[model samples]
Target: MTMKWKGWALATGALAFSATAMAAPPSAEMISFACAGCHGTNGGSAGLTMPSLASQSKTAIVDAMKKFKSGERPSTVMGRLAKGYTDADFDAMATFFSKQKFHPTTQAVNAAKVKKGEALQEANCSRCHLEDGKEGKDDTPVMASQWLPYLQMQMDLYQSGARKMPEKMAEKVKPLSKEDLDALLHFYASVK
Candidate 1:
């Protein structure tokens, strides 16, 4: 090839390489490390109040982060933390967390409450929160094997209107008494 043609070819090749590198998505592991401090390594939270993100649905993670970022979701720290991330950042982290396996935390729960909770879950929540609340559908988060305290906190938020609950969920939970709520928590905690 002529020298001038060869130079032009090299320049074009270099430009293409640079564009390819820039177009590549961000590293999921690198971006997700920011979550390890609170959500635990690979999103399996060790803290009782922090819900585990591992094995959560990607859509759920993205929606929650977006709400937190927009201040639509009430939170002490997540809102602040989420504000710093972009849609791409959220997608990367969500993809990483969604792929990790969820390991349930073991806790002692009242058997009686678990029974009532099971019945309540089947009657009211089964349609959406399938797999006995272990698996999530669409934007729903996994409820089974979640931290009991976290579950309680979220329920309290929904009940108090601090966090917006879905219309169906609100209708279902509206008639439930405090005791009934506690029973549901126990039932979720009991699920493996």
Candidate 2:
């Protein structure tokens, strides 16, 4: 092809790429004022009931918001709040939080608890959560750096039917002893 023709084609491609990038949605900070009280500025929550959004998958975050807004996933607090969010707000929030790194905590974990948790995780949880519990695929959220209290609360919820989970997950965790549950929570929470 002629040099002039090639130059024109390159220029056209660059312009199209720039336009697409510029059209991409803004970050969560634009709409986070509504969520900051419970979810914190970076998606880490002080409340045990609130799950951290740092490093969470964008699709998962968006889906959860949809569920909350629809009343399919029941949350007294989130349901009411989510109802007020637009699709654009949800997308921007998800995109923003997904890009943030998790804040590491300095909480001390019991050595014995950590050891037992590691063993229990390897035996029962590793298949799904993998070695770090952060290497998730698809809908699974990263659990490696999750808060201990939140982990425990979720397990209890799953066991008691508070958190509606899939049949497979419910079935797998149905037989866990109290100690096993404690160990699993400790192991996951201790991971950096």
User: C-alpha displacement of 171 in model 1, angstroms?
Assistant: 1.2
For all predictions, the C-alpha RMSD in Å is 5.2, 7.5
**lDDT per residue, candidate 1, 1-192, as tens digits?**
356855675777864655553454559888998898998988888798999898889999999999999998899999999988899999999999989997688987899999999999999989998898888657999888788899999988988889999898889988999999999999998898
The residue pairs in collision within model 1 are none
lDDT of 2 by residue, 32-150 (tens): 65576777768766665567787777877888889889887756788888888898899888878778786455455777988998888887767767656765445667777677877
Highest lDDT: which candidate? 1
The local distance difference test score of model 2 is 0.73
| Top candidate when judged by TM-score against the true structure | 1
> Candidate 2: worst 10 consecutive residues by lDDT?
18-27
